[model samples]
Target: VEVRPNPGGKGFVTALGGKWGWSGSGRAFVPQLVMYAGPADYHNKPKKIDADIETYLVGHGFNGFHTIVCCRWFDINEERSTRIKGPAPNPDPRTFEALELLIGKVHSAGGMVHIWAWGDESRRQTPVRLGGKNGLADLRLQRYIAARLGPIPGWTMGYGYDLDEWVARKDLDIWHRHMHAQLGWPHLLGGRSVGPNRYRRGAKFPQIYEGLDYSGYEQHQPTYEAYVAALAARPKRPSFSEDRFRVRKPSPYPKKDYTEELTRRGLWHSTMAGGVANIWGKYVRRGQKTTFQPYDHPEWIKTNALFFKGRFVKDMIRDNQITDGVCLRRPTGEHFVFYKEGAESIRMDLSKMPGSRRAVAVDALKPYREIDLGELRPENQTWKAPQKSDWAVAVGEFRK
Candidate 1:
C-alpha cells in the first residue's frame, strides 16, 4: 500500500518519495491514486477535453511508484463515440497519448493500473456506446483497452456497473472469461452503490457474487460479517470494500478520531473473510472536498502498516487459514480467532475447531508482542486483550 509522511504537507503536492509499504512478505497492496477521467463535473463538458493527467500525477505521485492506480471512465467514449463506434475502431490519438503518458508515470511510480469503466451508474451519465447498451459496449471497451494497454504486464480492467443492472447482464460469464483468458488479467467484475436504499428497494446484490471473480461496493450491510457471509457463499470470489474515507470532522488539520479504528476493524474483517485473494480495502475521503489525504490521520496508515507488516497476519490472510465470519466456519480441528475490542478480553468458541491449543492476545498497534493464554481446550476460552485500546487477539496453536 502507498503512504506519505505524517501531516502530508500543505498543498496537493508531497515529496515524491517516502515510506511506502510495510517491510514484510505478503503485505497488502494499496492504490497510489484513483484517477477520474473525463470532465470533473457529473456531465460532459464539450470543451473540457481529456483528463488533467499532468495535475493528477503532480499531486499524487511518490518515488515513481504508485502500487495501484484506478482510472474512472466517464466521457471519452461519448465524446469520441461518432468516429469510434466500432469496437475495434482505431485508438484515439488524443486519448491514447494522454493514457500512455499517465500510465508511464504510474509505471515509474511502481504501480499497477485499474480502469473503472463505469457501467450504468448514477455517477456517470454516459454509458459505454460500443454495443448500444446491448452489453456489447463492455466487450468493445475491454478490447480497446486490451489492444492499447494489454501488453503492459501490471494492469487490470473492471466496471462500476450498478447492482441491479449488473445482475441482469447475461454476458457476465462470457465477459469474465474473455478478460481472464484473452487479456490474462484478473477481472474484478462487480458494482458499487450497495447503500441501504438499494437493499430496501427489494434488491439483493450480494447473491450475484457467485458469478464475479472479485466483488466491490462502498455501502453494503451494516457489519463486516454480513458482507463476509455473502462473499463466503462463493469461497472462490473475493470482496473489495471501498469504505468511504473515515474522517472525524471537517478540518484541514489531521484529526485522531477519523474512524481509523473502525476502518481497521473492517480491513481485518475483510482480511479474514476473503484471505489475500478476496480482500482489497480502500479508504476514501467523503464530503465535497476532492483531495484525498487519509495518511494525515495517524492510525489510518499505522493500523494498515502493522497489519500488513506482521508475517503471521500476511500468511493467515494469504493461505485462507482464517475462518471467522458468517456462512464460513472455522477450520475444523484447528482455528484462529482474531477480534478487536475495548474490553480486557473476549470469549472464543472453539467448538468446531478442535485440537486447539491456546489464545495469544496480539497488539494491533504494535503487533509484535504476544500474551500467552496458557493451555486451552476446544471450548470457550477467555482471551485477554493485549493492549488497553485498539487491541486484537489471536486464538490458535502457536508457541504457547
Candidate 2:
C-alpha cells in the first residue's frame, strides 16, 4: 500500500470557483493518539494477525496511524500495581521482533508508528521489567532490536512526559542527549488521566487530582522559563485552542472559548480518552457491546472526527487564506495573511522561516481515506463554552 501525495491535491478549497475538494470542510485526516490494550505481550505474536483495523482506517481517509509499540511495558504509579507476566531484565525476543514487523507494516501503509513510554517509565532513568524484561534496560533492548530493524520509516516517538514535563526537560537541556533520546525518535508526549468528561464534578478520583498536581499550568512556567533561558529567547507561542477530551459520550465538559482558542492556536492535546482498552478491547473487537463511542458505533467517530477535522481545515484555510472568492495574500515572508473585505488569520510554517528550525512546526499530512472519528452531533449537554470557564485557562496554564 505505497501512497504518494496527490501532487497539488484536488485543492480542498480552491481559490478558483471549484467545489470544496473534500465533501464537508475539505481536509484529509485528523492526527491520532492510540493506546494499546487486550493481550499483554512481552512477545505478542499472532500468526494470523488481523490488520482489519489498519485496513478499516485506510477506508476512512486517515492520513496515518499511530501504533503503540513497546509500552504498557510497565505501569508504575502510586496505585497498586500488578507486574505483567514474562521475563524481566532480559528482552523478550518475540515481542521485540513483532514490533519490527508492526513498524514495517505501518510504514508500508504510509502510517506512522509511535513507540510510547508511559507512567514512571518517562520519569525513571532506570530500567525495569516489561513483560519479561525491565523497561529501563529494555529500552536499550528496543534500541538493539531497532538496530536490527533499521529505520523502517513512518514512525513517531512518544515519551511519557506531560506537556509541562517536556518544557521542564527541555529547560534542563539534556533531553536531546538522554538514553531515550538516543533512539532519535520523534516526540509525541502524553500522560493525562481523568478528563472532565470522566468526572461528574470536574474531577472524580483523588488520584486524578494528584496527577494534575504535577500537570498544572503554573508548574509549567518554570518549564517554559527554562525553555526561554536555554533556547536563548523567542516569541511567545502562537495562540491555538488546546483541549483534552473524555469518553462516555456527551462530553461531560466542553468549553467554548478555549475551543476557539485551540482553533485559533492551531494546536492541541487530544486523547483517544480511554486507558489501554480503547484500542485493544473495543476498536479491535467485532460485534461486542462497546463501552466507547467510536468503537461501538463507527458513525460516532466519523461525525465527531469531522467536527474536529473541520476546525483544522478552518484554521489552515484561515491562515493560508487560499481564497478565490475570499481573496488571499501573503503580506510578509511566513505570514499567510487572509483578506476579503477584512483580515482573518495568518498561516506560518515556522520551520520555513529563519531561526525557526528548532521551533514547533505546522504540517499537512497526505489523505488516507478512512474514518476513525464517529458521527458529529451537537456538543453533549455537559459541554460548556471554552472561555466561559477556567477549562481553557487551566489548560493554557497546564504546560505554561
Candidate 3:
C-alpha cells in the first residue's frame, strides 16, 4: 500500500494503490504494545497469541501495534546473555516465520504494524553493534529485514525506542539509505526520541533527522498545550506518540504514577492537537515465558468511537478561540468539537457558524451515554453538561 502524509500534514492516506485503505475518519493511527521475547521462549503458542492480539485490536478500535523486534530486556547484557547475538538475520527461521504470521494477521485485520528494532533499553544496540566498522553488516541486516518484510502491507519501520540516546544522526542516515535502497515498496520510516523527565528535556529526533516520514515522541505525561506546541513546532509531517505512559489497573507500580484516566485524556489531547498516532502502552507479564490477554476497558473503545465513528476528525483543526475549552473545528465552520477537563458549562461563539445545528455531549468518564443537546441556532451559546466530570461535545450537522 502507498501510505503517505495527508495533504494537511495532520494524518496519513493509503488511497494511492493496494488492497488496504484508510479505515476510520479519525485519520490517526493508534497502536497497541507487543514485546516479543525472542523465539526460544515465546514461540510455543504463536498462533493463539496472534489471534488474541488481532481480536483485541479489531475489537477495541486499535489499528496497529508498537512491537519490539528483539528479545525483551535486550539492553541488559546479563539478562540477554547470548540470547541475541547481533542485529538482524536472527539465525532462527521460526522467528521470522512468527513475525510474518503476525504481520499477515495484522494486515488481514486491516491494521498496521510499527516495528521497533529495539526496546526501551537503548544502550546495548549501538552503531558498532549494528556493524558500523565497515557498514557492510548494517547494510546486510537492513537488506535482510527489507527483503523479508518489505512486501507486507500496513506496516512502518522505526529505528527503535529511545533512539536518540544511543544512535547518532550520521549512522541513522546511513541506515535509512540502506533500507531505502532495499525496499521496493513505499513505507514510512521513523524513530522514537527521548521521553520527558524531571529535567523537561524535549525530543530532538524531529529536528535532527530530515528523512523521517513522521516524528515520534515518548511523552509520559502529555498535555494539550504540550502537544499543541509540539505540533506547531513540526508542521511538515505527522506526529506520533510512541509512548504516553502505560495503562495498567490495580496499581502495578508502588506509586501508581500513571493511570487509565491520564492515558484517556492524553489520547484526546493529542488527537485534538493534530498528532497522527499514539500507542497504548499495555504490557505483557515480564518473564522468560511471555503471555498476553486482551484488556476489558471500554473507555478506549468509546474514545475511538467518538473520533472515528462520531466525528470527521480528518477535516478538523485545533481552534481554541471558538470556545473556552479545547476546541477543534472544521475550517468551514460546519462542525465543532470541544473537550473540557472539568464538569462545567462551556461558552462557545457560534455566531459565525450560521444555520441550525445539532449538538451532542458525552462525558469523558462515561462516553457511552451521550446526552443530546437538541437543535441549536447559529449564535453565541452556552452549553451545559448533565453532571460534573470531564466531557466532550460535538456540534454540527447530525447524521443518522
TM-scores for all candidates: the values are 0.56, 0.40, 0.79
lDDT tens readout by residue for model 1, 286-373: 6744443323433433443343333233223322233222112233445464554455655555655656566555565553455677
lDDT tens digits by residue: candidate 3, 1-400 = 8766444222222421111124332343334333333433334566665665545564555566555654332222223323556654233455556567666676666566677765433445433454442265546556766788776656776777666666667756777777778887667777766644221335333434766666676665666766776566566666666653555544466242356566567667766675446666555556554454344565555554455453634546788887888887888888888878785888888888868788878877764666889887889888887677777888896342
lDDT of each: 0.41, 0.28, 0.59
In candidate 3, position 32 carries an lDDT of: 36
Model 2 C-alpha lDDT per residue in residues 1-400, reported as the tens digit of each score? 8956654322221111111112222432333433332213313444322353343344332333333333332331111123444445444455446566665554455444445433334443223333322234554555654454433444433333243332333322332234335444322222333222222222221111221111211111111112122112111111101122222223323331112222211211221110010111122223443232124333323333333332222222222223221211122323221111111222223223222211111111212132122221222112122122111101000011
- Which of the predicted structures, 2 or 3, would earn the higher lDDT when compared with the native? 3
| Better candidate number, 1 or 3, judged by lDDT | 3
Worst 10 residues of 3 by lDDT: 11-20
93: Cα error in model 1, Å: 5.0
What candidate 2 gets wrong by more than 4 Å, as runs, is: 1-30, 33-50, 54-56, 66-88, 120-139, 145-150, 161-175, 179-246, 249-400
What's model 2's lDDT at 314? Answer: 20
What C-alpha RMSD separates each model from the true structure? Answer: 11.0, 15.0, 5.7
What root-mean-square deviation over C-alphas does model 1 reach? 11.0
Worst 10 residues of 1 by lDDT: 11-20
Top candidate, metric TM-score: 3
